[model samples]
Target: MKKITQELIDRFYDLLSPCRLCPRNCGVDRINGELGNCGAGLEVKVASYHQHFGEEPPLVGRSGSGTIFFSHCNLHCVFCQNYEISQLGQGQRVSLEELAQYMLDLQNSGCHNINLVTPTPWVPQIVSGLKIAQERGLHIPVVYNCGGYEAVSTLKLLDGIIDIYMPDIKYSDDQCAEKYSKVKNYWSVVRSALKEMYYQVGNLKLSRGIAASGLLIRHLVLPNQLAGTKECFKFIAENLSIKIVVNVMAQYYPTFNAHKYPEINRRITLSEYRAAIDILKSYGLDAGFQQTIDTLYRKAIPEWGEWS
Candidate 1:
């Protein structure tokens, strides 16, 4: 593994001037306080940091996944359950040192890994913080939990740094992506992003029944076939390794601005979720962790930031 050097940190921070950290390529100078489409600055802002057991069983043993919810998102999804944190940007800015301390603190709490949620816009600063965190004995695997929309160039910068590349494979159809998430060419971008991530770290590796490294994809089952599981699973099975674990998430509940779009205004039915899972299984993709339909009904819909 490559050590997080000051030179490497500088290399990432320099990208802030042009700010092509995400797929948006907004070209805004984030260093000079110019907000890009992602609405993040040079500093890293975190909404919350805690040991969350709500994650997958492998990620959450007896302890929990050390989850850090970052504010703002690259994709403006109409049904974002965590709109307050992702779209509204409800979080506090923390210095690089402070971010490093959070890593150590989470490690001290006996959590498995540092799970960074919606960390797309803050990659540069996150790397800077990791430099400090690693030097201070932060030895646990770092999970890059992000939305599927990612820049391959930006992801390359984190090739060796990010241990577990856990990302959401939102949609296989670009039209659905643009309509729901308001992102252009999302399917094209995500396909490349997943390839790069899998290239960096292949399939999920477990130690003592806990995830230590590699890729775990999430595909949220949307109401009405908006998620397009067949094509998404086909791509993963044919392009990436079928051994790669995929979490077929059925927790989509209408929130935020979802009511504006009638197609996705209601929660997904059990049959809809099951069909998506069938698609996943047909592709020979490992259904990593699953929630029973009864369990889904019994539990409250967790905010995306909190859902892991």
Candidate 2:
């Protein structure tokens, strides 16, 4: 009922032939089992799906957000917390029908929304499943939770289908992005993607204190300002309004191969978090959330499942 038209679905699946779902543009025929840079094959692979409360406030209202964690990300960050799923591809390959069932099950369990994490590569398949799920009385809002790297053309296919766009503004500098996430054009791509997403779903809107639709950005403050928080805040304030909800994440630690880089080999200091908060205020970006620095001491490992 939310405009997942047959024509739109068809156009999205066509992208799979050349596999230009994300910015990689691998051109590999994913329909024929050619793997792309995202490490995903033609099959729809899902790491897990559950009512997760570890998300943002509005998304975690009384019933948690129904999060379907997709394996293999478009931007495989070297310091990825869910390295097992994103790097090693630890997930179960599911058919489009099965994926729809998963959505229906989550809705039945009283989830706030269907949160699709790292879903770029499998957009076509996800949309197909969404069509079936919507037809089967699945009406919960669909949240496109993704890494910053996205293609505008691919996102256009999801125009009316996706209600919430929660994306990360990983780096303000392309050089830092290339070094950290192996993406040289990340800054440029994300800017366009964020603009398109904002155009689709304006600022964050809530219904009875629950997020009904909008764009919420997550900016993970890395050690020694490696995330370029200053420039990021400025860009968001100038381009995308300062009133946009932004989650200033402070839970950064040396995860996976992060230790390989000395600059990011340790947890961020309280001063660093304060600096980011200061920048946020300087930009008049008050509509967002920030984590307590004390939580970083608790050793919050990623909730993603094991490699087995």
Cand. 2 Cα-lDDT: 0.88
- Candidate 1 shows a clash count of 0
Off by over 4 Å in 1: 300-308
* Residue 42 in model 1: lDDT: 76
Q: Determine which window of 10 residues in candidate 2 has minimal summed lDDT.
A: 299-308
lDDT of 1 by residue, 116-235 (tens): 999899999888888899888999999999888999998999999999999999998889999989998999999999999999998888898788888999889899998988998999
The deviation in Å at residue 122 for candidate 2 is 0.6
lDDT of each residue in 108-141, candidate 2, tens digit only:
9999999999999899999999999999999989
Q: Runs in model 2 with CA error above 4 Å? A: 299-308
For model 2, which pairs clash?
A: none
Clashing residue pairs found in predicted model 1: none
